[model samples]
Target: MEQTHSRVAVVTGGSGGIGRAVAERLGADGMNVVVAYSGNTERAAEVVKAVEAAGGRAVAGRADVAEPDEVDALFDTAEREFGGVDVVVNTAGIMILKPLVEFDLDDLDRMHRTNIRGTFVVSRAAARRLRSGGALINFSTSVTRLALPTYSAYAASKGAVDALTLVLARELRGRDITVNAVAPGPTATPLFLDGKPQEVVERMAGQAPLERLGTPDDIATAVAFLAGPARWVNGQVVYVNGGIA
Candidate 1:
């Protein structure tokens, strides 16, 4: 829990598109990054290699952030391999699209378990034990603001994340830590393009004022900002959507 020297950052879902970008950005800032992944071990390792290639220190591990024990181990591993943890960025989440009436309870349960419960578990760990000047960055979605169709369950889960970040910021008022959420609009990631017709996807992308989909690096910039020197920012949800919503 040392915050004085170079900091350590744990980024959940660091194997994925946006998570990889954020991890790399934090590493470039002279912080050691712990790339936490749930399923993609090889991808996580590749991310670690990339970080190292950039002259940054990084390690890859597996953990289901929704589980307390796993999260504890994740932190312990990061602290043990590196020195200590000073920042946590949660980018692990899933999205299922369905009409409200047709949304299955099973899907809701799974999504909630990862998106909401995962944030609660990992964030609590950060608040309780992370060193002073640490930052906890959570993820939400712009769908919550747009109230887009077929995003009922997903939006609900992100709404919970938003609420949690705000409350935790106040709860840790004197801790010299910041709690915030990054809500990305539409990003051109593999997970986002699946199961959609090209025309439909293009139409969706065109909806944004930028006239294109966002890149993982775009959201990563916001994450790196909140996780690095944005100490004055807390309990805020920064939407990196390119004016989509």
Candidate 2:
């Protein structure tokens, strides 16, 4: 890999497992990171401290990516404080697992609002304000390809993201911007581990070729590639699943 230079990157949901890893990796890559968190101010602050300790500049802020006004303010804050956004890695996501017949309508709607709508809100802002040669990265999941049981609603939301990434890539063709999605499989995050039995978790991990669940660093490596020095790879969903799907 080439040496990384200083830049600014906005990472959403950046206080949690995957988000924190991506933010730190980008910081290590010499980017000023803006850690966007939805609910955990303390965790977000901790991430900022870690980034700074790694000799990278970073700050934490709150924004529900599903809200347009909040999203606008987030961009404004990044531009106002750290210059401008050179890259955006959207790690914000939600997973509500239940069979289609058993899933409640409110759960489905909330998932869609956060996963689908939130990605759109952030990507739309990025398309308008991202610096030249910048990149916009969205998150999807391996479930879209795996078609796992009880994943219909969640996969549908991410499927929208997969399609939207392609559309946005074409839409930004003349601007030298790259749009892509990172689809991770069975990662060992709180979101992935929550409510699952130990046996079930181990089984999922065993499905991967590496016979282990992914770590935050595993997904962050892919996001870093897309956001910095991988501009030529565009409009695709790169699966970081250890070849499970």
Clash count for each candidate, listed in order shown: 0, 0
Tens digit per residue, CA lDDT, model 1, 83-122: 7889999999999999999999999999999999999999
* C-alpha lDDT values of all predictions: 0.91, 0.92
User: What digit string (tens of lDDT, one per residue) describes model 2 on residues 169-209?
Assistant: 99997898899999999999999999999999999999998
Q: Give the range where candidate 2 is weakest over 10 consecutive residues by summed lDDT.
A: 1-10
lDDT of 2: 0.92
> What lDDT score is found at residue 198 in candidate 2?
100
List candidate 1 segments past 4 Å from native: 1-3
Best by lDDT: 2
